[model samples]
Target: MKILIIEDEKDMLQNMQDTLVKQGYIVESASDLDSAISKVGVYDYDCILLDINLPDGSGMDILNFLKKNDKTEGVIIVSARNSLDDRIRGLNTGADDYIAKPFHMAELNARVKALLRRKNFEGSDLLKIGNLCIDSEKHTSTTQHGEMELNRKEFDILTYLATNQDRLVSKSALAEHVWGDHIDQADNFEFIYSQIKNLRKKLKEVKADIEIKAVYGIGYKLTLS
Candidate 1:
């Protein structure tokens, strides 16, 4: 999944980004409110790790703006404030969860997973389609015939396909979801084609009966036939 970390503390922001990256998430960060707001407006993220105290504005202000813009992205408040009112205010302001400062990174990771599950997978870890099985927590995909390990991007593509099974997902959508802010650096979308090719090949080798069909100029679709 893609995540945005809005934190002013350089060390904290880097640590959180690195941890989430190792956990197989695409992460982008901003240290101030304006940059944070710009990211929230332009991109789609599965979740946002928002700090209440930013360099220029309150984290709650960013939250309010996101809410006002009708963005449904999951948000978790990571703040130093441990007051009851602060926690209550964050939740009331549309944060999915709140983690106070001096928190365990492991626990924060757990909350992120839980929030993603609630938002995307109906609070489940396993994503299944036909004979294929995906363990979101472990970031693994398997078939009844055998097990197949996937690279990070391949796993992300498959997971996305499983989530939107039977729907046509455009190339731009896939690119945005997988690479997030780095898509602009690419000269072309040939990389997307390559990832899909690899994912399809692996599934086929395992005798999995899933199909990823090209929608010609648009994109692709995962069909169970």
Candidate 2:
């Protein structure tokens, strides 16, 4: 999953970024409201960790912008403002959850995982498709035959396909979601093709009942074989 951390505190922002990265999430961060708005406008995220107080403006403005534009990223207000009014305002503004400062990284990780489950997997940790079972919490994929050995990008691609099973997933969307902001640095989508190729071989090795089907000119889709 991808996460955006909008925080002004240098130490706190770095800490949050490092923690999420260790948890296998693609993370990007902004220190002020302007960059935060710019990033939010241009990219998509699975979750956002927002600070109510920014150097340039209130994080509330960012939330308002998200709502006005109908962005569906899950947001958690990670701010020092812990007053009831602050919490109410944030929740009313569309934050999915809130965490006060002086918090543990483990707790923050848990909140992110919970919000992702609620948003993507219908609050379930297991995503089952055909004979394949994916434990999103554990970051593992297995079939009735056995576990599939996959690299990080391969697993990410497979998980994404599982989430959108039976639906077309545009290659650009897959690259953006898996590679995060770094997708802009790529010259072409040969990298994506490479990952999907290896993932397909692994799936076949495990004799998974699922398959990743290419859509000729547009994208790919996952379906039962």
Candidate 3:
């Protein structure tokens, strides 16, 4: 999954990013409100870790922007302000969870995983589609044939598609979600096609009951075979 960290403290930002990356999530970050808005404007994320205080502006605007735009990304406020009023304001504004500063990375990771499960997997770590079972927390998938072998990108792609099963996913959105900030450096979406092709081959090998079907010039969708 992809995560966006909106924070001002350089040390805390780096710590959060590193911790989540170690947990096998594609992580991106912005240190201030402007950069945070810019990122949220472009890409889609599974979860967002937001700090209400920023060097330039309030992070509340970002939350409002997300709500106004109807973006589906789960948001967790990670602010230093732990006041009852502040927590209430954040939740009322559209945050899914809240955690104060000076927190354990483990707890933060747990919150992230919980939010992702609720938002994407129907409050469970396992996404069961046909004979395929994907454990989001473990970052692994199994079929009736047993566990399937997939590289990082392939797994990310499969997970994203599975979450949006039966829906057509645009190539650009897939690239942005899976590759995060790095997709800006690419000139085309050839890499997405390549990854999908390889994932299809692996799915076929395992005799998985799911199929990723391409829509020619559009993108792809995952459906039960």
Candidate 4:
């Protein structure tokens, strides 16, 4: 998943990035409101961690902007303002969850996962398609026959496919979701093709009946036998 951390504290920003990256998430950081606004406009993130206090402006402004734009990105307010009213205000302004300052990293991670489940998977951690099972929390995939470990990109591709199972997902959509803003500079989508190939191979090896079908002029779709 992709995440945006809008925090002014350099140390806190790095900590959040490190924690999320270790869990196989793509993370971007912005220390002020301007940068956060710019990044939000150009990039797509599954979730955003916003601090209520920033050097330039209140993080609430960013949340309000996102609401006004009709952006459906998940949002969590992480701030030192532990007052009940502050938390209430954040939620009322469109924040999905609130995390007070001095919180444990584990809790933060849990909250993020919860928010993602609520937004994308109907609050389920395990995604099932026929005999194949994907555990979003463990980042693992298994079939009735056996289980196989997937690399980061492969896992990402599989997850994206599973989420949109039975629907045609365009190559450009995969490129944008997987590679994020970096896809603009890429020369070709060979890497995406390779990832899909590897993912299909792994599933087949495990005797999984799931199939990824190419759409020729379009993209691909995940179909179950």
For each candidate in the order shown, give its overall lDDT on alpha carbons. Answer: 0.89, 0.92, 0.91, 0.89
Worst 10 residues of 4 by lDDT: 175-184
TM-score preference between candidates 1 and 3, better one: 3
lDDT of 1 at 23: 87
Top candidate by lDDT: 2
Q: Return the top candidate by TM-score.
A: 3
Candidate 3: the clashing residue pairs are none
* C-alpha RMSD for every candidate: 1.6, 1.3, 1.2, 1.9
lDDT of 2 by residue, 1-225 (tens): 889999999999999999999999999999999999999999888899999999889999989999999999999999999999999999999999999998999999999999999988889998889899988887889988899887788888888888888999988889998988878878888888899899889999999988899998788999999
Cα RMSD, model 4: 1.9
What residue pairs clash in candidate 2, if any at all?
none
Q: What is the lDDT of candidate 2?
A: 0.92
lDDT of 2 at 12: 97
Error of 2 at 210 (Å): 1.7
Residue by residue across 1-225, what tens digits does model 3's lDDT show? 899999889999999999999988899999989989999988888899999999998888988999999998899999999999989999999999999988999999999999999998999989999999998877788888878888888989999999899999998889888888788788889989899989988888888999999999899999999
Q: Model 2: which ten-residue window has the lowest total lDDT?
A: 181-190
Give a tens-digit lDDT track for model 4, residues 22-119: 88787878999999999888777899999999999999999988988888889999999999999999999999999998988999999999999987
